[model samples]
Target: MSLHESVLCSTLPSQGTGTLTLHDLQTGTPLALFKHTSSSSRCVAVIPTRAGLGGVAIAAQVDKAVLNVYSFQKDQVLLKCVLPERLACTAVDKRGLLCAGGTAQGRIYLWEKLASGALCNVWDAHYRQVTTLAFSHDGDALVSGSDDAGISVWSVSRLLDGDAQNTPVPLLNFSDHTLPITDVVVGIGRFPSCRLVSASVDCSVKLWDFSTNTLLTTFLLPRPISHVVFDATERLIFAVANGPEGDIYQVNLLRRRDDHVEAVGGAGVNDIIRLGMENKNEQDPASGKISVGEEVTVLSLSLTSSLLLAGTVAGFVHVYDVHSHQRLRSISVGAKITNVYAMLRPPDLFGHTSLVAREGSIPVRPIAPLQRTRATEWEGKEVGVLLAPFGKETAESLINYPSDELQRDFALLLHTSPSNVREEPATATNARVAELEAEISHLRGQLGRAKGVNDAMWEAMVRKVVAQEKEKNNADEGRIKKKGKKDH
Candidate 1:
């Protein structure tokens, strides 16, 4: 039996069609989903304010021109704001301030929240279509990468332009990347202060030391990149790419004493369902004794990197030993898996929520564009679907099913499959990789100019743009209403 056979499964309402489902990983249940009502909800980010601060936020893009905000309670749509026409990307600060990008325009929108919990201001600070957005750990600033081949930083406090002698404050724009930036993430552990890592369509993941606003290192990917993320504790960085064939890779980033960089292949190129942190290995400093623990991918991993918890695209969430890459046990959500959202709950429980699995529909952006008629049919299927695997309840659900005996037999067979191991590629090729690294450097240098503007000036420009757009939308609505009245 395969791993799928041993796991129990259940279906969630194919959530709202076209929505991104974020499950509470700690409880192993669906928490909230950010759905695209008109266009598409590209990304969903949940930033938890300090514990007991009583605020957690979720932000998602809608129609490429608007971002919707929902509190953790999943109640009340907190904010809705229009942005540039084509919002290709979005990200949020720890305090729930939002940053978003547009295509062709290379502009980044900086959204701030008022003390009264309302959206305070919006600014257009970039000169090109922004592709990726990241925020400092402290939420004091935001980082934006654009197709214009530049990464720009905006100070959140600078929203109050008068503080700097009543002069308009300019955003710190860093011009790099010959190609469009695909993804950006703040540093996890050792490189903590305002450090960030960004991956580009140029097939490179570059680390930036924000304190200096300069590139620290550039790492290569096996193919054109798709998405990138950091491990729970930030000890590891993972990137995925689209290949001619169906292949994916999970690589680890490491720094060498010679100032050279290496992209060690830590996980193999199978269609990676989800990349997350697992298993934290803690060691005693005095005796150098190592304590091995469960390999669970939790929202936060331990200092030793021994415990990790992550859900998969296969509808199963596993808590396993990272060193051994062994599945301690797995829970299968009945639906094909999408994304996993992990949360921490009570003392013994850790939530591992799985998103709607990717099946039937192809990823929105394929490397090679197919003709309209040749695209996969996504019309009939329900959207926003997810599977949540319960712990004992999952086991019991299977055991009590009408076909309990068949389920038990299937479980036994899974216990016997060739171990269902996950393999990693070797890291032996560094020289040729470095040569390619040089090519990547050349690309980053060949990008165009990215202009910066004063925060106040940009804010005023955006407010005017938003007001005009709102009026146009209202006028269109009025015309539609008049037509309906006439027909009636």
Candidate 2:
């Protein structure tokens, strides 16, 4: 049996009890729900188990700290475990062998899975309130970030291999950020060595070379980063920032530049309203305008890296096309979204399809570029006929499906094979080729600029290190002279 793509969202209660809801990401339908007896849930972590099974660990606040672990086979929960701890955050290793939880008081506890579906062998790891934790690709290392602005990389093997008498030390300690660290993720790419990335509340993101324990580069964003998810290729970072009017940015990892893609908050209400009016006449009275001061609180990226899901404080989940940056759909969940996790189906579940299948396919003559004309001229007019044989009722039926189903069909259409789509005119094909060439040229220039910046930063670091070494030598000479005078 193959697993299906799903999304797990933890809700923060506005006036009632909190709950964890799971939905099929492809269709946006509720799959399962687990009600929490507590008032609020803080963080969640997913652990991938054998035979395609998985488990979710949630930290909820009650009279005492509690960690609720739910084991799942596919879309249903199989088992649950309630542990004692006021965990601020949690992380699990790739193999689900190790689980780590960060506490509100800055302590880290590690747990090992047992055969009885329980987590055991708990141990302390961090001294300060840990904000985020992530396992390395190989599962041999664990990286943690804390409110103290310190990052520690621990040797998972050593930590697990040691006995109760011995404690393990961190392999590297990074303390460069001035503010609290919000998120930390281990990098995955075609790089020669291991890399780690950290986002801080100080409005900066730092990339580190784990092998050398050196900071590789830093990127400054417009606002403090609230959440971040890397693309499948790890070449792009999709991030949501903290503010009343939250904005989403696509940051090129290699070029180190931020591109504002979409505005999900109340600042873009006018644009959204205009779009709604253009799409429909006499908008539904029940669909009121998005209020001012709504903030996007959570973000998740689909496995294909083709869709982005953003959840707001106003109980709305907006999905956007990663390539076009267009809003695809907005869903109401009826509660503030505290966490959003996108789970991908196993590769065996679906046939292999090219992500850019339509890149060279049918560029059906751009609908005359949509000239600005009077609405009365086109209203209720059949300006064009469908190329394929389709009845009016069939077209209306396709359009009348629920929004989630329509969105799923749209995604499927994007993934259709190139051979299935109609071919474009020669003139249009040549124009598209030219556009691609220009884009490639622009990217090359950006790559060169990025390299130049990296080189300059490396030189500056060398100079600073040399100055420090010279100062240390002078101090040593002064101490030697003082010793000689004392001897005389």
Candidate 3:
């Protein structure tokens, strides 16, 4: 089946029967839909599994104490497990190794090696009800926010160290905001380079570098920020303010005061961009922004398509172009959307959780159900869970490998026929194969420009490396000549 480059998922919270829907990132086409009773704000996280199908989403159901693991490809709930506490927000690492949830009582619960619930830890990570939670880029740290206006970064490695007598304290804590925090976004950088952006009811967004344990910059806005989101590149940030006539604010991380600042309309800060304000950009209708009303509940961004999704309480999701400030598509979901998650979905993954092999496709492995690690008296306190690998693993699906076989395969496929070179007798299989071949042909037609850019970048990097090596050789030769003259 042909799938879009990314998937946009949202859940209805206030309806009599909660609904979960996944749509194409750009066209807003429904990919999958199902009825799910559990819902909450910031409740769903769709992650990419090793298997190509829709990776499992860790969804926190508000009406009940259990969380539902939904498989996007299968369009069904994989598992529903009871939680130790009532969770308000939940997050999973990119590797799907850990599942973190924030409880209404202001505690953070982490299940490490999710398949083996054995590595469970709970800590009082906040003062009031926890509002949001996010895993750091490397998944080595977890960032949690609470209604008490506190943001804490917890070290995952240290927590699992298990040598300490008591629970470990957070790696760092920022108590700058005075009101409840609505959302937090962690960049894909480690150590001193890592940045954490947060929005709160205090009408301000603060950027912090956890490594130095200090605030980097604060962007004060006109109204309270209801949601904050970072694109895949993290170059731009989208922060939505609450209330009627609320406009979406765009903040550029790479920009400085030196920039011309022509794109934004009367921005309060050089780095913070004010988008789509009708009063200021009246002459340029395209410059004007969409006035997302107070009822807007969920906001998700697709960097691939440069589209911003705004889900409102009135059961409508409006897609707006971030660059042109034009509304692209509006989807009427017919219910209040409380939880929404947008992610890049990989192609041709497994059809189900069973890891059944399909023709001309590879199965992306899914994480197994949560289990406990039992400690025996003989082993004392050090208990470890061992994962015995059992699943379909394709040689090409492996991201990290020492062999250049993938490069060779790419080159070989260039001359290969567009259709599956293998002849098949079945009509349904042939039709599916033909459809895939046409999709491949269409993609290759568009890949020329992108492929050129990609090759240019690679060649440029290779040339730089070659030049550095040449310089090093020249320096060594000059040193040898000087040494020989000294010896003579």
lDDT by residue (tens digit), candidate 3, 1-488? 22234445555655466767766655666656766655778887767645333356667777777777766555667777776667899888877778888888997777753445544667777779999999887888888999999988888887666443476688788888889999999987775477788999998887776767877667777689999888777667778878765477776666445755333222222444333433565334343335765467878876453777888878777877777767777777777887766664444333423233343333334445443332122234333333334674542344323334434433333323324333444898889999999999999978987999999999999999999999999999999999999999
Ranking of models by lDDT? 3, 2, 1
Candidate 3 displacement at residue 184 in angstroms: 0.7
Q: Which residue runs does candidate 3 get wrong by more than 4 Å?
A: 1-3, 51-54, 163-165, 254-289, 345-488
Best by lDDT: 3
Model 1: per-residue lDDT, tens digit, 121-220? 3445556666667677776666777766777776666753323234324456555567877667776433236567677787776666666656666666
Please report how far candidate 3 places residue 50 from its true position, in Å.
2.1
Question: For model 2, what is the alpha-carbon lDDT of residue 453?
Answer: 100
Tens digits of lDDT, candidate 2, 1-488? 22356677777866766666767776777766667533232367665322322244444444445555554422333334444556677777766556676776776666654322223334455566788888887787878888888898887777766555556678889888888888887876322267777888987766677767777666666578777776766666666678777666565554323775432222211211111123322223222112223698877787677878888888767877776666777766779887777775322111223111222211111111111111223235433222423542322232133554445544554565445445566999899999999999999999999999999999999999999999999999999999999999
Q: What is the TM-score of each candidate against the true structure?
A: 0.48, 0.60, 0.69
- Assess each prediction's global lDDT (C-alpha) against the native: 0.45, 0.61, 0.68
Candidate 3 yields a Cα-based lDDT of: 0.68
Candidate RMSDs in Å, in order, are: 31.9, 27.4, 16.8
List the candidate 2 regions with Cα displacement exceeding 4 Å. 1-4, 37-42, 48-63, 73-84, 114-127, 189-192, 255-293, 345-414, 418-488
Model 1 stretches astray by more than 4 angstroms = 1-16, 20-42, 49-56, 74-86, 97-104, 114-124, 162-173, 188-192, 232-235, 244-341, 345-488
Whole-model lDDT, candidate 2? 0.61
Residue 475's lDDT in candidate 2: 100
Candidate 3, residue 466: the lDDT equals 100
Clashes of 2: 2
